[model samples]
Target chain A: NAGVTQTPKFRVLKTGQSMTLLCAQDMNHEYMYWYRQDPGMGLRLIHYSVGEGTTAKGEVPDGYNVSRLKKQNFLLGLESAAPSQTSVYFCASTALLGATGELFFGEGSRLTVL
Target chain B: AQSVSQHNHHVILSEAASLELGCNYSYGGTVNLFWYVQYPGQHLQLLLKYFSGDPLVKGIKGFEAEFIKSKFSFNLRKPSVQWSDTAEYFCAVNVQDYKLSFGAGTTVTVRA
Candidate 1:
């Protein structure tokens, strides 16, 4: 099963450019998320959606936007790219249970903002 | 505010050596713990998780972790390492609202 997939594995952007990263899941999960990984910074949450059409901000939501229009897809957008946004971005989704949560992650999108 | 920490920034070991990596989270209430591995040029995959019931959870690839509630720690361990075990490991804590806080990650290098 192609549990989680991300499009455009690598991309380079100029400052102030806009771009979108697409994430798709085939497991029919209810929760989707966006995270960025940097040296010594871990994978900080950028945005998340509980279900289709519902979005929420997480620990680090600045300079990023997310949309979940379909149950199987979540999109992350960078309105104005900056050097700070140059990091490996990962998309993850999980099936919702009562309290416990488990995640299935995509390969990742390597973005470079020059 | 909740956060996760992985103590080992990097580790090098010979094949067949025992492995232990420390992970800790800062959360007052109930929390979900997870260990994910990212092999070179690959995606992150779940190694194991701790929800409840038992403190120790075994996952694929002969990996396991012990959850010590009093210590607020969930340390990952493997009885023996293999050359194929070289990868980056991440520790995470699932907080309320289904958001995961990940650690900085530990890079493990196993020499064949």
Candidate 2:
């Protein structure tokens, strides 16, 4: 059902370049999140949206921005890529916030900044 | 800020050996706990979760976890392990139903 889909499965950007990562969910969920996974460090939230037109900062929001103009899509943007920002990004969605519903995650987008 | 901890960073075991991975969270109030597994080159999949009732929860692949409120711990266990059980395991906590915080994952390697 394409529970969660992330675009640009892999990308390489030079320092100071900009790019956007797209996440789409067909689950009709209300909560969507962007997270980065690094070696040894599990998954850290970058940004999140409770619903369409609403977005909020997460634990690790530096160097990134997010938009949720539509309920099914959440976009994470890196205005200026940095070596530290090179990590695997994941998108997740849940039917409800603060509930027991499990998160549906995307395969992940691997970004490398040089 | 709330935080989650997974004590075992890397674990190796022989096939059929029992398994246990320790997880602890720092929060006093009510919380929802989750255990997710990531196989090689795959997305994170929920193994099990605990919401309100039943501290002992059983999940897929013959895995289970028990919630100990006093200890603020939710430890995962399996009676028997297989080579296919090798994967990275994560412990997550949902506080106030708003944000999910994840622990530094534990990598389990099972030798057949």
Over 4 Å off, model 2:
none
Best model per DockQ: 2
What is the CA-based DockQ of model 1? 0.63
Off by over 4 Å in 1: A97-100
Q: Summarize candidate 2's per-residue lDDT along B1-112 as a digit string, tens digits.
A: 8999999999999999999999999999999999999999999999999998889999999999999999999999999999999999999998866678999999999999
Whole-model lDDT, candidate 2?
Answer: 0.95
Any residue pairs clashing in model 2, and if so which?
Answer: A98-B97
* Candidate 1 global lDDT: 0.92
* Chain A TM-score of candidate 1 vs. true chain A: 0.96
The per-prediction tally of clashing pairs is: 0, 1
The TM-score values for the models, in the order shown, are 0.95, 0.98
- DockQ of each candidate's interface versus the true one? 0.63, 0.78
Which residue pairs collide in model 1, if any? Answer: none
TM-score of chain A of each: 0.96, 0.97
